[model samples]
Structures are given as C-alpha cells and as structure tokens.
Target: MLNGPLLVTERLILRPPAAEDFDAFAAMCTEEETMRFIGGACSRSAAWRQWCTLAGAWHIRGFSMFSVIERSTGEWVGRLGPWEPDGWPAPEVGYGVRASFAGKGYAFEGAVAACDFAIEFLKWPQLMHCIDPANTRSQALAKRLGAANAGATRLPPPFETAPVDAWTQSADQWRQKRKEF
Candidate 1:
C-alpha cells in the first residue's frame, strides 16, 4: 500500500490522506486567497477524486502526495509531496496549506519534508515545482527547496489558463543546499 506515517518535520507530520480529510481539502482549494494562485475552486467531488488519485499513485508508482498535519493539534493543514504531473520531466513537488494556516510556515515545513523524501527515499534525480510567475510565495518556496529557475514550459494545452515556469531541483543540488537546514 506504500502507506503509513512516512516522514516528520519539526512542526509537521506527513502521512497518507484519509477520507475524513476530503472536506478540509476541498475547503482549502475553494478559499479565495489560498487558491488564488493555483486556479479556481475545486468541487468537493473533484477534491475527493483527486485525493483518491493521489493515494492510488502511491500504490501504482510508490510515491504520492503526503497529507500534511500539524503535529501539535493533529489538524489537516493541507498536502505536500511529490507527483508526476502530466508532461512533466520529473515528479513535481507541490503543496497547499489550509487558508487559516497560510503564512504560518506549514507549507515550508511540509515542502522541506517532501523534498527530503524525494531526495533520500525516492532517490529521484530531479524534481520540479511548476509555478505561476505571479505566485511569488510559491516561487520563493521552491527556491527554499533548492530549485532553480528553469524557465517556462508550455502549459499542457488543456490548462491553457494556467501559468508557466518549471523550477527544477537536482538530487545533487538538493543534497548540497539542504545542509543549511
């Protein structure tokens, strides 16, 4: 099942998502500010389906999104982990923090944990964090994870409305930069 409590950070716990987390995931995706850079609200059904797909990916490929939780309260802050987005050259690292939790370092905590997993566990040679140029916060987060500005790649035509720019991190690069943490 490739399932269990996988990794932990200073303030976050990375685990597989549970059914009860659907509501929080949907709400986080629907919030104005929380979702502003990622596109529009995702329907509740869509969110659950997405969550299932994330878990399914783990069984199928051995890696997928980790539901991020607050260690202190056990609250579902959001998700952070790795996935192979369609057309991406490598598994992309992505994350989202619940609206109320944004700006509180949860995203960074979860992201760093995911990056560590990608490097240490998955042993992926490369990772990407595609972002909208206007999404400075996410871009900065990518930078914090040791991803460099890799420039834009064409948005899959279906998502013509989405932004471009694929920030990339090599395993060697991550190992070097991660020492600072």
Candidate 2:
C-alpha cells in the first residue's frame, strides 16, 4: 500500500517495506547480536509487531526505515533509512544489517543513500543517530558519515532506561560532508 522512492546503490536496493520482507526482518530481529543494542532478541510475534510499526510509518508519517536488499542476490540484507517516531529526540537516519552481512560496508552504502533522502527529500534540517554507548561499530559508522557526538539523551518509554549518545550534523554540514563521498 505504500509506494515510496526506490534507492539503488552499487550493491543494494533500498525501498519501502513489503510483505515479502517479513521473514528476513523477523530473522534479523531475533538474532541476539543483531538485536543486542536494539532492545534484545524478540519473538517472531514481537517482530511482526515491530515490522508492522515500521511499515505503518510509511503510511502515517510518509517515511520510515527502508528494507535493504542485496542487488546481486536479491536477498533481504536489512533496513536503513529515515526514522522519527513520536517523542523521538530528532530526525534520524538509522541502519541495521543482517549478521551475515556485517563488515561488508552495506550499512554504510545504504545509510548514505538514506541520509540523502532524509535531507534532500524529507527536507529535515538536521540528522541524528542515537547509539548505545557500547555500540562502537555504529559510533564509528556515524563518524564515517560525518556526524559528531553531541552528548547523551534518553529515549522515549520502553527504552527510556537505556543509555544512548546522540550523534548529529546539520543539513548544511551533511551537504558539505557528502561531497567527500
């Protein structure tokens, strides 16, 4: 029901969530390492609800995390894109890739595209990535994306107890940084 823009990179395709993406989405949500900083592994039913929440954002908010697909194999790699649910600290370009695809730069590629979409199309003035303190990999990714640690912030309920650092850069800063890519 959601028809949004399709972003294609050299190795991946980023698009709105589709029904066929559920199995992979659920699998990613259930992986302990994958979900460790993302509120821990969840049951398939919980994953379904989360997937629905992501999908529903497209309809309700006109934007959400995009389902990432491997271009060559057409496999679901993960989800990455603009996300800002109610009570969010700021507009964010978040990312998560399947464990099997870790360290492959797919997350970076997809995130770059997502940042462009968020800043250019969504017209957000700033972008932020809320990362747990222990998530060094993500912190490094944020640095690679030209975002700087702006300090800490508590998330909305359910995750309010979790500690996270905010990494941010304004649209103008992103535009300047993007030219280096």
CA lDDT scores, all candidates in order: 0.80, 0.94
The runs of at least 3 residues in candidate 1 whose Cα sits more than 4 Å from the true structure, single-residue gaps closed, are: 1-5
Q: Which residue pairs come into collision in candidate 2?
A: none
Candidate 1 CA-lDDT value? 0.80
**Tens-digit per-residue lDDT, 73-156, candidate 2:** 999999989999899899889999999999999999999999999999999999999999999999999999999999998889
Candidate 1, position 73, lDDT = 93
lDDT tens digits, residues 1-181, model 1?
3275568788888988777677788888778788776655677777777778887887788788888878899889988788885665457888888888989988987887888888788888887887888889998888887888888765555566676688997889888888887
Q: What is the TM-score of each candidate against the true structure?
A: 0.91, 0.98
Error of 1 at 167 (Å): 0.7
Task: For candidate 2, give the lDDT of residue 172.
Answer: 98
Q: Which stretches of model 2 miss by more than 4 angstroms? A: none
**33, model 1: CA deviation in Å?**
2.1
